[model samples]
Target: MPTVDAVVRCPIAPTFRVSQLAGMFDLPPEPHTERRFQVELPGLDQPWQVGLIVGPSGSGKTTVAAAAYGRRLRKRLRWRRDRAVVDGFDRRLSTRAITQALVACGLGSPPAWCRPYHTLSTGEQFRADLARGLVSPGKLLVLDEFTSVVDRPAARLACHAVRRALDRQTFAKRLIAVTCHEDVARWLRPDWVLRMPEGTLTRRCLRRPRLRLEIFRCRHDVWPLFAPHHYLTGKLNHAARCYAGLVDGELATFAATLNHFRPDRLRISRLVTLPKFQGVGLGGAMLDGMGSLLSEAGAESITINAGHPAVIGHCNRSAKWEFRRLYKTGRKPSGMYLQHPHWKTSAGRAVATFRWKFS
Candidate 1:
């Protein structure tokens, strides 16, 4: 623990009018003077995953971090304006590692990945910058102005996505997020927090609040909201039953299930979670809820086969989901097997089928 006692100050020449105003307001005679910070923040060189340095704007937050961290703090990252966002990651990293970093930082949409960084939405660019910063292997990664460019809800939601990303790491790595917004601290669930001005270090093992989603059958018109996030085509099946999962009255996930050749059988057509809620298994929750809805409506067998890596991982981890089979996407079945409807929707990639039931 480096008990920092740094003095933060800037030169000020109070004019006669300013001095008179200060005296009128009973303010300090020598205004805007230096202040000393004795922060007991520790564990920069130690083992940790995520930490935060947060306070109000102009509370000497950045000044304190610079005094303690120095060159380790990455204030800004330069991106190629002409290239796609996916291409902006460090060139030394493998494709898998790059994609993993993108997923971890909540930039999970492949379409957005292919677009130039400057063309993305503010929230999308924030996640992309975080992904680029985290893809490199290091013991410490310091980010300043964390979540400063987005709205309050988006900032909180992105924090959860970032938490999920850091939690997935099996290797040694850590992040120190510098921000002014305090609301995101709980959502980020940081291991430690260093409050500025006060210079207080509070070690915490905080957890983000549990979010429950209410599922409802929604109109197909709402698919436009989720289509941009999906990797597949934006088109939904004509007869597909659409459903939406909401958190706090906002749509967080969208899913579509189609009736198979047999009335009792069902196949999931599309399951998409908004980028803000990605990497937290809401997509799987949408699937589970849709299965229950169809089950009550006379669906005896609800089968799902998705191509997204996150979707596949979620299905494998869920007790309600069981592996049915795996087959090449380009393969064709002969005779009676050719009648299976699953082959019609997914092609050109390997697909794993799973059966869903309440656990």
Candidate 2:
């Protein structure tokens, strides 16, 4: 067994306004205080993967983690205001690795990756930070105030994504999350949990909550909420049926399915998972669910037109979907062009199109 001890102390000003206010409340006007963090491990047989320190504000979570790990603990990610999310990672890592890391952290949108870090939403920025942290070379990664800024659902999904990413790492690295939110404990499933204030430490056998997804028909007006996340520019098809996938009553994925020119064929034109909920298989699940629904409704087959490589790859691997063809610029494919004709690649060439048929 290994033991660790940490002690933190700081001086306070007795003559300050805070002290005067404390006097009015009949509280102690102490000039200094000390906090201790002591722990003993049961055995050195198994390697620790994740350590969590949770408590409310001013509970000394940061101080204890810093004292215990010191320079080995990476607390804050270095960020450039104008740099793209992909460019913020370590230069030594390959582009593929960086992209995988970003996607693993739930920032999977192509448009989101190209934008400057400062332009990202609060949730996107949080995931970007986690992505960078996950790829950086470090043995002890300490994330202070984990999920403190995002809403509860985003935080939970982020925790799940990060945990899965960490599990897939080929190297030996330990993660320590210092947070006030205990709701993520189930998703994080940390090997060790250190509770501040009470100073309680426990080894947990946590299981991830089964995500209950509810797919329901939604109106076309819901398109605006998910349109910004889509890589291509387009308006919703007038004849399309929009569907939303909700997890715990929160919107997680959206899709637009429209009937093809032939009465027996249906095509999925738009499929998008919200930024916070990406990389969780929600988009694929929604597509499959909607396809099954239409198939049972007498539709012979369903088709999907996708430009993203990730979506294309997923379709190529699924047994229910078959790759129809790939079309480049200046070429007309067999099926009708669901995407706008004006949508071209940066090089003025037609973007690579991947078509899949699902039954």
Index of the highest-TM-score prediction: 1
Q: Give lDDT tens digits, candidate 1, residues 148-256.
A: 8898888888888778767866224678899999998888999889997687888887878888999988999999999988897888877888889999999899988
lDDT of 1: 0.80
What lDDT does candidate 1 reach at residue 278? 74
Model 1 misses residue 164 by how many Å? 2.1
TM of each candidate vs. truth: 0.87, 0.81
Question: Clashing pairs in model 1?
Answer: none
- Candidate 1 regions exceeding 4 Å error are 9-33, 45-47, 328-344, 357-359
RMSD values, in order shown? 3.5, 4.4
Summed backbone clashes in each candidate are 0, 0
Task: Put down candidate 2 lDDT per residue, 169-249, tens digits, no spaces.
Answer: 732466788899999999988998988877788988489887878988999999899998887865777788899889989
